[model samples]
Target: MIVTADLAMSLDGYIAGTGVSPDNPGGDGAEPLFEWIHNLASWRERQGMTGGEENRDSELMREWFDATGAVVMGRMMFDTGEEFWGDNPPFRTPVFVLTHRPRPTLVKEGGTTYTFVTDGIHSALEQAKAVAGGRNVDIAGGASTVRQYLAAGLVDEMQLHVVPALLGDGLRLFDGPGLGPRRLEPVRVVDTPLAAHLTYRFAT
Candidate 1:
């Protein structure tokens, strides 16, 4: 099973704008990054909402959701998304959360269960893979989580929805030192009015 991470990023390389908190999860000026997918039929369906545009973006979203069996995400992502997700989370699979604090397993509706992993990224991935049943394991993230997996060479593929807007200062996806220099082979590119869907596989 391939380990993949997907994120909507700004033209300036920021996945999230500055001042990210539980109160303001995506942070300031981050709306442009995700505005593309918010109204997609696939996304709306997952959120239990109705009536959204059925287009290439929605189709791509459906494909990704269908391919993923389990997910691993950072604690911050979980905390910030918990309230917004309500009882029925979009992920209808097991989700292993990487966090230092130990918390009991949280079972939500729609087959989504949050299993807090205090050990580390490796431990969280291991557990996610074990339960994935050969389906792809997704690194569902908030920038930092995706960076950790990429640094460790755990991500097999990455899909970046590059939005046109730019965020001058925020959480850059490729920031920090651990990543160094690496070659990424382009798998595909689907350009749309809202964003450009870029898929890449790490070159071996």
Candidate 2:
């Protein structure tokens, strides 16, 4: 199965604002950073079942959703504290989260279940791959998980959502050690008023 990583970053490359506080929260509340994705038709159709996607970015977003099978996330994403994903979640596939803290196996009514992976990213990837079959395993977000996959050379594709915002600092997605040189060729580019969607395939 193919392993793909996807994330959204500011123009200055920051994922969240300077301080990881509660009031300020993630860079620009983090919601504005991903409003572009939330507005996509595929995102609504697959995630919420309502919304109009009529731009290039939405088109690419739909393509990514269609290409994905299983998804993986980090502890920070599983928390109900920092990120508020409203009453209903947007993901419909099985999602595995990496963390040392154990939690109950989440089985959402909308078809999403949060499984904790204390064993590590390797274990999570193995499980994700088995569940993904031949479609593709997707790395949802969080810098650490992506870095681990990159270092292991397990990522086959990457999609970056470059939003026009500056968070100064928060979590740098590319801050960790560089794993040699992995070539990423752009497969698709979508420009919109909100964000630019860039999809690339790993070429090493």
Say which candidate scores most in lDDT.
1
Clashes of each: 0, 3
Per-residue accuracy of model 1 over 1-204 as CA lDDT, tens digit each: 999999999888999988999998899989998788889999999999999999999999999999999999999999998998899999999999999999999999999999999989999999999999899999989788998999999999999999999899999989887997889999999999988999999998
lDDT of 1 at 177: 73
Best by TM-score: 1
- Against the hidden reference, what TM-scores do the models get? 0.98, 0.85
RMSD of 2: 2.6
- lDDT against true structure, model 2: 0.75
- CA lDDT of every candidate: 0.93, 0.75
- Model 2, which residues run further than 4 Å from truth? 21-25, 28-32, 46-49, 80-83
* CA displacement after TM-score superposition, residue 19 of candidate 1 (Å): 0.5
lDDT of 2 by residue, 101-139 (tens): 998887775666778889988899888888775778898
